[model samples]
Target: MENNLLNLRMTSKMLSRQAKRCQKEENKELEKLKKAISAGGTEEARIYASNAIRKKSERLNITKMASRVDAVASRVQTALTMQQVVRSMGITVVSMEKAAQSMNLEQISAVMDKFEQQFEDLDVQTGYMEGAIGGTTALDMPQDEVDMLIQRTADQDGLELNAELANIQAPQYLPDEAS
Candidate 1:
């Protein structure tokens, strides 16, 4: 459980780092587009600048991607908190299970088995998410590839879970001026 908490913290830090980098890139692109628009006064230059502006706008519309990432980060943070709570609950379960040793064997076994199954599911979810984001593994690939890999893994495990399943909830956007 301590290890899981540590990994969750590390994953959160990584996601924060990635989001910052994306924001920086987006800002740089926006600045370049603004400069081109302002300086390209000639007709020919204006045409080129118009193309650049269009491309930049397309990129900017990719704020959807950023928003998705932010939503996923928020969900991951929430999941980490829940995992910690579950770990604490697990301790209680362990104690109770120990005490229940004197009870009927079949009943205790069933309860313990259920808890074990839930823990396994939690662990698999963590592992799958970690791998998808290059968190714990060394798979330095593209986002599509990562998504495909995660999807394949999920399918293999009969999980049928959406690896790219990010909530579209509004995040508390940090303003550029604040920093």
Candidate 2:
């Protein structure tokens, strides 16, 4: 199971790389499309557009395959862990059975009494209630407090992401914005 998990992870990584390469090729195809459009080559632009669309679908398919492989790997790992736990529990049960055979009836009765008394002495519910008495969760926040937090963080971010750079990619193909 461990080996199977490892193989699944490796396959997922390989597929992810394949997806990356597909995206790289798709970008190149899009660039060719822009150039073809700029040169007024209608047939060439159509071909490049078709190729770019195919590459995008290929990338998406590869990504989906990788996700499925990862999910399989996770299940295999969980099963392997459960198998180990069950094996350990079986050994523990055997040990307990052997020890039980050595204990006398009165000894077992005394142990059971002590266990019951200890359980009765522990106030688990009260301890938990005390811990949670003053606890506050996000859902407990008042509307006014939520509004204050939003206003406090309402300032514009200093970071700049110039998305216009994508349009200006083919400078010769696109007219200047100022013009």
Candidate 3:
């Protein structure tokens, strides 16, 4: 996994460099096209302009492809980070269970209950984490209720909702009397 991530980072860097090179080439072609268009009335100029446009289009395509490669790298990085977090959570649960083994039955029951409650809290937190990572959340409250809740919170903080800012006019500059 670490090797894969390293390769991905390298690939991303290479793609970014290629994209920059393509952009520079595109700019050169655009400048040539502008020159050709300005120095008009020749068949050679027309041909050069057409070729420049095609080359610029190809360069833009390459830049877009590089951007896609970077995006893929970013997603892979996020997945790897989440995997680490999950592995740590699993280890924590195992350690907690092992510790409970040294306790009396009543103590074990109490520890188990505590672990259960902690797991429930973890589950809630996991849901929120997933929601944040996935870019969408499951809203238990209705839209109107959520709006009202937000309004109440805002009111508690002395905030005005949907209030427009006052429009202040800029001071007019006056010319010097001597001028």
Measured by TM-score, how close is model 3 to the native structure?
0.52
Question: Ranking under lDDT, best-scoring first?
Answer: 2, 3, 1
TM-score, prediction 1: 0.37
Cα error, candidate 2, residue 39 (Å):
1.5
Candidate 3, residue 70: lDDT: 53
Q: lDDT score of model 3?
A: 0.61
On TM-score, the candidate that comes out on top is 2
| CA displacement after TM-score superposition, residue 113 of candidate 3 (Å) | 15
Report the lDDT tens digits of candidate 3 across residue range 117-139: 66676667667555543432223
Q: RMSD in angstroms, all models?
A: 15.4, 14.8, 14.3
The better candidate by TM-score, 2 or 3, is: 2
Model 3 misplacement above 4 A? 104-179
- Where does candidate 1 have its weakest 10-residue lDDT segment? 167-176
Candidate 2 regions off by >4 Å?
Answer: 104-179
Query: Residue-wise lDDT of candidate 1 within 14-79, one digit each (tens)?
Result: 655665665566566566656666776456456555665665565544443444454455456547
lDDT per residue as tens, model 2, 1-179: 78887998899799989999999999999999999999999999999999999999999988877777766666675566557656655665565565579776765565566555444434453344333322212234565555444433342353333554222222232222356
